[model samples]
Target: MRVLVTEPLSEAGLALLRRDFQVDVREDLTDPEALAAAIGPYDALIVRSQTRVTARVLEAGERLKVVARAGIGLDNVDVEAATRRGILVVNAPQSNIVSAAEHTIALLLAQARNIPQAHAALRAGRWERARYQGVELAGKTLGIVGLGRVGAMVAQRALAFGMRVIAHDPYVPRERAREMGVDLMPSLEALLVQSDFVSLHLPRTPQTEGLIGAHELSLMKEGARLVNTARGGIVDEEALAKAIADGHLGGAALDVFAQEPPGDSPLFHLENVVVTPHLGAATAEAQDKAGTQIAEMVRLALAGEFVPYAVNLSAGAEVPEVVRPFLGLAERLGALCTGLADGALRSIECAFLGRIAEADTRVLTLAVLKGALSPIVHEPVSFVNAPIIAAERGIAVSEVRSTVSRDYVNLVALRAETEDGEVEVAGTLVGRRERLTQVLGFELEMAPARYMVFLTYEDRPGVIGRVGTILGEHGINIATMEVAREAAGGLALMGLTVDSPVPPDVLEEVRGAVRASAIRSIVLPA
Candidate 1:
């Protein structure tokens, strides 16, 4: 297979790809047309932040099976367009964990110790030891936000520095944080109030944008410093600048700005502020790791094997063992409702209960969107792009967090209110050690494998046999089937596991003949 590696990736990442395919390595591909034209014959394409895999590039790469990013952000690539073409997109998430974590720590130390000011004063031939006096890190309290990979690592390093570290991450397990010797704070306000230094390691989202505004800055101890090496716009730059100018806060060191190559910001002129040109991921070690990881991901994608670090891995074709077949519960549930007889969706709500609630629920939410929107859109869908896709299609999304669930353990419900009306469907994580679950409020629980037919019909004695006969006649054999009913002759749900994908035409035929409320063809991971 031919693979195109665009942008400067590490030699290690390329070595893995080179072992299996003919490789084209280019440091730049700024011209979209030229890149598109050259990428047509390649089976896989790899890129960093510079390359743009637009619709043109996607369409041109007729044989393209995968597009891998050497870094975390998907903003550079057109992920939705790729998904529509059934092209797998992967990224190296763990490769840069250490790099980012270390950078956050470095910025924190620089701000706390006033290293930049001290160095500048020394270079200016001024003894100024008293003026540039710094504080010791030991015995100070460090507050960390968003306890993902980077946050956890930052906590570890801060603890080693003899600083008491406390963190606030709604998603992380309390036990895990305790094991790491990091105090888990109840809220952002609590962390800010108690910390001598506050650091951000959160993702960029609407909820997180400007999260550290004037109100939050006011909560910090007067002399507390702040550091941000995560995404730009995560902190209110304007608010921070005002706080510093008014002597409300001590100082700040920012490695990222709301805008890259910032467009004339006041923070640059401040003597108390230390800024870097977004160098959090600039280390040679990080670049090499990200590149190598993407290369390995592409190798697995080409070979039809599992690729970890996929932002949308749970939603995509590759399935891991822990969740097993239960992963498909969200996808199938989405498919059952997206294609069903309903009005447009005014709002979409997802509920995570029991064990599934304990795990990362973000992937589960995206999986539902993937199965629901795959048939309607023309591109590959992703977590980063899922919300965007829904917005464009005029759908509202709402997620519910609850642990008040038992027996079924984890339950996912999608409610769609279209022009026709509003309809709600729910599912849950079920089955034994191997992991199987029921989707779409169905009573049926089966191993998550490919090609299943989910049918909603009037509860009746002969409906199952009639549906079975229709499938058998169409050369579609049912591997397994289970039914759930509200009451006899009332509404019922059935999950039919099949050997092959039930073609759309065949599904329409079954829907029409059986007079069922809905019928959808679904493929899930095993």
Candidate 2:
């Protein structure tokens, strides 16, 4: 295998790649046409932020199995295009967390003390002592916009400076915030109003673009400074400039702009404003970690092994040992829920119970999403694009975890809300085998197979026999079956796996014979 490094990478990473694969370092391949011409021979391509892995480039690299980014973001890479071509896109997301957090603190301190202005004034041979006097960080309230890895680290460091730390992140649980010694604000507006200084540590998504606009900036405490090291366009640059110019905000420090190499802007002339050329992940240690981490990920991808940092894999990667056994169960349950759904899907909720909930169940959740989408969509659905597809279809997805299990030692459940009603399916791993434990509140144990059928009818005798008779008449073989009831003759559910898919007409006949309230024939992936 051969790997191409388009940008500068750490020598350590290059050496590691050279151990198993032939490596080529071409720092001059900055142009897209040049990269496309040189990419055909390599099996893997690695780059930093400078290289743009366009669709044309991916098309030219017929042998490329993976595209690796040494940095935290994939903004320069055409991920969707690569995914379509079956090329794995991997990134070192965690390699720059500490560096970014430290940079945020540096910016916070710089803005608070007007460090850059003071240094510039002193260098210009001006004695400006009282003119450059700044406020102390002690006793100030620091508000974090997103309580993610970097935000949490920033909170820890700010606390060390004797600053009261609070945060606003809907995705973060309240207990998690409390454990971090930070107060969780009810809303962004509330956090902005009370915070003496606000720091942004959020990803740049559609919803987050211009998140802190003029109105949000106006809500902040008078004279409160702002610092952004997360992503560009998250904070409205024009709004920030106006806020600072009108003396509403004391100062602002920006490490990233909406556009790299941003041309002249009004914020450039502000006295208290400090800007850097996107140096949040510029530390030598960060670069080395990014290179080494991405190299290992690429190596794993090349070897067809599990890669924890792969952003586009549907399975193997990111699944913990305990959660690995439940991936199939989760996906099967997802397919079952969708199969049982009566109307258009509106939302999906994945609940993890028992010991499995203690692990990082993201991969399992992704499996569920992939399963839910694969059956209905015209295009292919993988773990990498399931979330995106769900969002595009306006389907809300959520995950809930609990360490306590009511019956099984571990359970993965999927509840999908549709326009008509909701359908729920739950499953668990039983000694390396998958078993369906619950379906729409009906509790029964049955192994899931490639072909399965579920039916709801009156708890009457011979209902199961009649269904079996119909299946037998249609030449459908029942592999396993289970019947659960709410009461003696009130309502009951029959679930069974078949050796072959039950014909649609045969399923209808069975439903009519048993007078089933609901019937669904589901076909799961092998």
Candidate 3:
């Protein structure tokens, strides 16, 4: 196997890759056409932020099994195009968290003290101490927008500075925030209103792009500063400049911009604004970590093993024979549980029971996460980034192994705890075919399908018939149906797999006709 390195990588990483595979370092392939020409002979390609792995380049690499990024962001790589070509994409997400957190703190202090301005003045042989007067961080409230790994670290550092930390992350549990010695606010507006300084640590997703705009900045406390070290395009640069210029905000600091190498922005002209050329992960230690971590990931991908940092691969490169049959079942169960769940999802637990528990079930857990998050999140969820996406949304995920199974030889159970209540869905393989075994503690046998409907209602003689009638009237055919009840005249659960999606109005009509307490129409991936 041969691996190609397009950009500068740590010598440690190059040595590691050279151990098993022939390695080639070509730092001059910065042009897309040049990369495409040189990529044909390589089995794996590794790069940093400077290289753009375009679709054309991926198309030219016929032997390419994987594309590895030494850093966290996949902005430079065409991930969707690679996935379509059955190429694995991997990245080192944990390589730069500490570096980024420290950089955020450095920028925060610089902005608060007007360090850059004062230093420039002193270098120019002038002294203006009063003009550079700055505010102290002690006794101030710091609002964190996204309380993921980097945000959590920033909170700890801020706490040591004697600053009160408040955060707004709907996906994070209040208990978790309390343990971090931080207060979890009910909403973003609430945090913004009380915080003396606001910091952003969110990913650049469709939901988060331009997250902090004019109105959001306007809501901040007067003279409150803003810090962004997470990603470019997350904060509205123009709005931030106006906020500082209008004197509504004391100052702002940014390590990233909407466009890299941003030539001239309105924010650059403002004396109160501090900017860096995206140096959040520029430390030597961070580069080494990123390079070494990505090398290991690429090696695993080449050896047909499970890679924890894979970005596009659906499942592990290798799977135990015994546990292989349940991979799809676990994902379907995850999607089912998520679909049936009500209110906000707080936590998800995956339990591997009986014989399957004996095998390495980490890939199966990743399958569940991918299934649970794919329907809701804006970006595509893969076996690798599922857990990260869950954490970002404050959704807790856990897994357990149990050798004991009540009935089936192997069972995969997915339970989702929502704000309203908990919903559990369990599945098993029946002679190589996936089947739904239990839902919400009600056990019934039914084959999983692309479109399904579940209903909870009072156990009555005609309730099931009423549901069937409504679906049939709408030209929806039921492929399979199962009903489970506690006892006579008790609460009952009915599940059905249909030939096509049941429209919402039709579901509503069925709900009313059957007088069902709850109903969910789920459309799972084929």
lDDT of each: 0.74, 0.84, 0.87
Superposed by TM-score, candidate 2 places the C-alpha of residue 384 at a distance from the truth, in angstroms, of 14
Global local distance difference test of model 3: 0.87
Q: Model 2: runs farther than 4 Å from truth?
A: 315-412, 415-526
Error of 1 at 385 (Å): 20
Considering lDDT, which of the candidate structures 2 and 3 is the better prediction for this target? Answer: 3
State the weakest 10-residue window (summed lDDT) of model 1: 430-439
Candidate 2 weakest lDDT stretch, 10 residues: 376-385
My TM-score estimates for the predictions, one after another, are 0.62, 0.66, 0.76
Tally clashing residue pairs in candidate 2.
0
Q: Write the per-residue lDDT of candidate 2 for residues 1-526, one digit (tens) a residue.
A: 9999998898888888999999999999978999999999999999988888999999999999999999877778887688778788888766777898999999999988889999999999998989888999999999998776678889999999999999986544465678789998889999999999999987675457788999999999899999999888989999999999999999999998898878998899999998999899898998899889878988998998877666556433435678767766787788787778876577899999999889999888888887776665422355555786566455789999999999989888888888677788888888998888889998888888988898999898788788888899888899989989999989998889899877778888988888999898888855
Residue by residue across 172-244, what tens digits does model 3's lDDT show? 6677788899999989899999999999988785557888999999999999999999888988888889999
Error of 2 at 429 (Å): 19
Record all residue pairs in model 3 with backbone atoms less than 3 Å apart, i.e. clashing.
Answer: 171-393, 171-394, 172-394
Model 2: lDDT equals 0.84
Q: After superposition, how far is residue 4 of candidate 2 from its true place, in Å?
A: 1.3
Question: What's the TM for model 2?
Answer: 0.66
Q: Mark the 10 consecutive residues where model 3 has the least summed lDDT.
A: 374-383
> In angstroms, how far off is 402's CA in candidate 1?
25
lDDT of 3 at 260: 85
Query: Whose TM-score is greatest here?
Result: 3
